[model samples]
Target: MSSSLASLALVQQKTGAAQLDRFGDPTIVGVALAYFAVIVGVSVWAARRTRTASDFFVAGHGIGLVALTVASVSTSVSGFAFIGGPGLLYSVGLGALFLILPAAVTNVLGAWVLAKRMRLLGEVRGLMTVPDAIGARYRSPMAQGLSGIAILVGIVGYMATNCLAMGYVLDAIFGVGVTWGIWIGMGVTLAYSVAGGILAGIYNDVFQGTLMAVASSAVFVYVLKLGGGMAGLSNAITPTDAGFLGPFGKMTPLAALSLFFVFGMGSLGQPQAVHKYYMLRDPKQLKWYPMLKTVGQLVVLLLYFGVGVGVKALVSAQRMAPLAKPDAATPSFLLQFTPALLAGIVFAGVAAATMGATNSFINIGAAVVTHDLPTALGRPLRNELRWGRISTLVLALLAGLIAQYSGALVAFLGVFGWGLFASTTVPALAIGLNWAGATRAGAIASIVTGLATTLTLETLAYLKLYAFPAGVSGTAVGLVLSLLVFFAGSWLTRARAAAAIDGDVRLVMDV
Candidate 1:
């Protein structure tokens, strides 16, 4: 039995080692190119239909439910599910559950708090972007502009993280320099985004999301086989290091739970995820959105669950050496153990998903810059569709530049981006829109507080200048403070009769 295990482990190690020599693998490159062509084709199809400002921004408010469900899953998951999530689990053990266990709950929560109301509001108000919703809710252009600015700041950081993650996969597949990969990845994403705007992004996401689902499920099955059974997998690890099986791994309980709170509550603020509301053709269809969306997300996320545990099990079985770092977990395992074709498929799927997700950010950031911010300052553009395209190109380039030059620092951007979005937007948009007591002053203050807390704490955490208590993260702390400030300001400054929320909005909230 021992000899058989040793032989199996040796075979796994040898296969894993082959990843380094796969640069010229035609099968991998061919699969990648095919996926790229599909994305471009989808974008072009969507771009043709995007003739007006309305069409460019929200797919003419006529997207199918299946597309919306998949796009939401795609935008919500991003490179984090494919690369970072698994890597964190492999390196940090159970602490990574803090990052993911909230996923299903949050999906349900977002759907409950946002889905129906957001769609109804968009139809009633002609809302296009998230800032539009916040602005409409508060009747303050300044509040809208500030929300736009906050979103753009976080979008830049979010784009930087995606570009960096994409670059790693591109480099591993093609033997190109990381810098080259970053430019190529950004350029491809910007091409479709600038040409088709949100219309392009949504369609691309539908395509990318489907591929990600299929690829991830396949890789997960392979992970199970490689790690033996779940029992075998567990036995391989628990005997040597029992901590790996702990509820919070090595992290403090507070930190683990903080992950839950931040992800669950903060998800309300993510524009890309919620912005899908603007494109839906039927508000009534959203009743079932949570179920379908969760299924898709869970499918893609299986890779995260499988690879994280599989790699740990392999290491414990003495079949594999420890990783150099956490982020390398996905790329390392894929290249080393999976068939070359499967590795390439996943590589392309992640790159596609990364670029597809980035396009949504670029689309919204452009909308804010060309429409929301300028309109708030009393200079709305007439040629909005044109400006949306131009702004997307410029913003994508800027994010790509930041991603390339910031090097390893881009990792910090992921944490900061997620935290900033949730902290800033949830109060003003999520709670404020639902609660009539929410005032302009309260909205602006919440946005500012969220912006300041997340930026200051995350930067300090990165610099090791301010270490959050073990279980409490910058995101959790920032969100709690922002909520407190928002509620306090709302209590102090009553809403005026002149600027009261729309009667219809109030009725919707009641139901």
Candidate 2:
């Protein structure tokens, strides 16, 4: 009987592999290839104009509102929306809606409050990266060095997350190894990113964003239909599986809190999202950014929640039991149900999403390494454009290497990346923008405290020391500690450092 069971397991694996190969439609591959080719072509065209460091890093601050909007949306969605979003909805019900709210708030606040300031500063100070802003504001090498290192670390993980998602999708659809997926995804991204720099990233994002939006809408509609329409699908699924219907559905108190903290507070520190402000043509464009960002966020929420809940209803737990990996759910759904053409389009969109995100990180990370770090270290690195392109390739390769080994879900990888950024930068960024008393010492303390607490909590959770409640998350703790350290440390040290810190904060706030 044991031998028979073992044999049955082997047969199931072989059968699944065979079905995947048989279903590997070449037309879909062709569409994907064409989409990638167009992106590469655009990058090659843009490369000629990328002659300076500023042009390479920030597109010479000339990106119009439309391109900026598309790039912003593309970077914001990334692999998380395509793969992790559906996966969360598939497993958790409606709890995923919570993710949308925080991001929306971030965009709105960013446009109204942060966007103008970032643009003004980028223009006035010739700032090219986040650490550049931080370093200039504080006039401290330690602060800049720490912030740059933190950005590099966080972005590498974030980029790896995209590669991980791409790898999972390819593995599911093509019966290929995860390593193959990483290499292919990385190679395609590097081809454009290394050649065209920020210009390539922006144009590809515009193209990819349009594709993603259309494909997402179609997928949402189809999934809704497959689940017997929205109302019927909701009714068919068990109450335990209806978390996708409401903000607070079925989530534990802790789990709900984690969602709010991770998604909401964490948004303030996302470099890819924040950097969009620096790329806008003018501060006046901020008026339209909120609307564009909101629409994108809403579309993302609907697409992920709809498909997730629908897939849950369409497939029984027993059937889905084999596809336990969340990252595999999106591809599995397309392969199992959708027509070949639609599936191929959706697949291309997924690939585009990952590329958009990976390229965004590459752009940001390159800026940090090539522009920000050199400025912070007081080292004059000439030929900024050359270094920026080189940095992009280096960071992409590092992320790909990391992605090859990371066995994290797309959402987990994204959240972890967000959390790292939040813990390190949120306190400084928020206070730097608002508070007049925020000092360099306070900012440094906050960074240290936030990083230490977050890393410790994350380590504990990984080791299963004490199960952190889902909603009351580790990042929440880190954020709270960061704020506390910033404020308390400021109060404690304000007497000696008051003049230097107060002057900078007042200058920023008074503007």
Candidate 3:
């Protein structure tokens, strides 16, 4: 039995060695670490000016256009873009291209419609947080409390998902244990986030976003070259493996449409993402904002699809078989093909992407707890700045713990958090801002219905029971239902409270 065990070990070592040869070198770990240090140093420096709750939560409402643009893209596109995106293309083929359409639409719509109005209102009303905006809109503590809780829940899960991706990258690149990777990643994010808050997050995001853009562009060029040029790479794939050219590839039409709705409309509702709009120094600076944002997004998405397609074409299926997990693709690709220095840059980019998103969520979640909850509970809550920092540390720890236990799938883990936020908050917030007839009762009913319906649908889907149709996401359903209840409830309650309504709400209808 001992001899048999020895033989098995020998065989495994040989196979592992062979896999490493085909995949690439493993010493890029040092390069990756150095890049991370530089980013953290920048974040620390940026934190020096964060003196108040407003500064910590929204950079004192003074974010310039360039900083806001970079931070927006970085925070919105997480490790999922760096890692899981390529893996999806590797497995599903061309159909994944459809995912880009919704992003394009959201960017244009946000720039033209949402960004200017939100910034105007945020400045006018002194709205520092999403719940603050909601509470002020309808004069309802219940709306504020519920929205804060929803933000916390969604952000915690989102933060955990990014941490999980960071851990996977460390383990793949450095042969580190998953536990050590998670702890180190968690520690770094908590240190910077707790120290500087939104200032730190936005600063690091600018640096990290630049790194991700450069690295992804370089990787795309190099991988295509290595794959024997575009034509050569195209010729290398089997008919089925050429899914990048197809309409839906492995995803059904419904599933493809679902991705669009989830990623697109979902952006309008994300607390961290939308919060950036509120922080801009001047709404006038937003004239070029959409163009800048779209260019960055296009570059990132193109590189993601390029890398995934290139890897599927160049790398042998047998070698990539073990890396069927989406989160494994980026590291596996680097370790197998790229040189040590460039590979290190890619790894650092991955970590930056993860940390950027995590910091954004941590700061946003802290804001929810410190600003929204205390006000909702009607507590005096003095020393608001101190509590905000404390809340950041606590929330980061909770999210890190969740990361430790989460499985390795990026999209699956992240979609729940994204879906929850979208269903519960997006409709109410969006409609409240646009419609004057929106009442407290309607907003409350909408929030409750959105939350309850999303949760129930998610639970049922998990149980393999009847689920919402494919193309129509839970978020879509929640948004539609929430809108219905919001309007209907407002209509039913309008006559009784018509005279008593506040000036801001009544201003539009009276006009």
Question: Which predicted model would earn the best TM-score?
Answer: 1
Query: Please, what are the lDDT tens digits per residue for candidate 2 over residues 1-511?
Result: 6985666566557646644764557877777778878887898898888788777778888999888988888888888888887887676667666766676677777666567777777787777887777776666777777788888888988899899888866665565777998888898888888888778889888888888888888888898777777777777676435444566666666676676776777777888877777788877877988888788767755667666776677554222334557676788777766777777887887788789889889988988887777767789588777887888888988999888876667787777788889878877775576665677888888888877877788667756686565546676788888888988987887775546643544465567
TM-score of 3: 0.89
Which candidate number maximizes lDDT? 1
Per-residue CA lDDT of candidate 3, range 74-179, in tens? 8777876776677777767665665566777788777764576677667767778888778877778889999888778888878887888788777766667666
lDDT of prediction 1: 0.84
Worst 10 residues of 2 by lDDT: 315-324
Among residues 3 or more apart in sequence or in different chains, the pairs in candidate 1 whose N, CA or C atoms overlap within 3 Å are 16-336, 254-471, 255-471
For model 1, give the 10-residue run with minimal summed lDDT.
Answer: 406-415
Error of 3 at 155 (Å): 0.7
What is the TM-score of each predicted model, taking all chains together? 0.94, 0.92, 0.89
Give every collision pair in model 2. Answer: 93-243, 93-244, 94-243, 94-244, 254-471, 255-471, 257-471, 258-471, 258-472
Candidates in descending TM-score order: 1, 2, 3
Candidate 1 — number of clashing residue pairs?
Answer: 3
Superposed Cα deviation of residue 331, candidate 3 (Å): 1.2
- For each candidate, the alpha-carbon lDDT, in order, equals 0.84, 0.76, 0.75
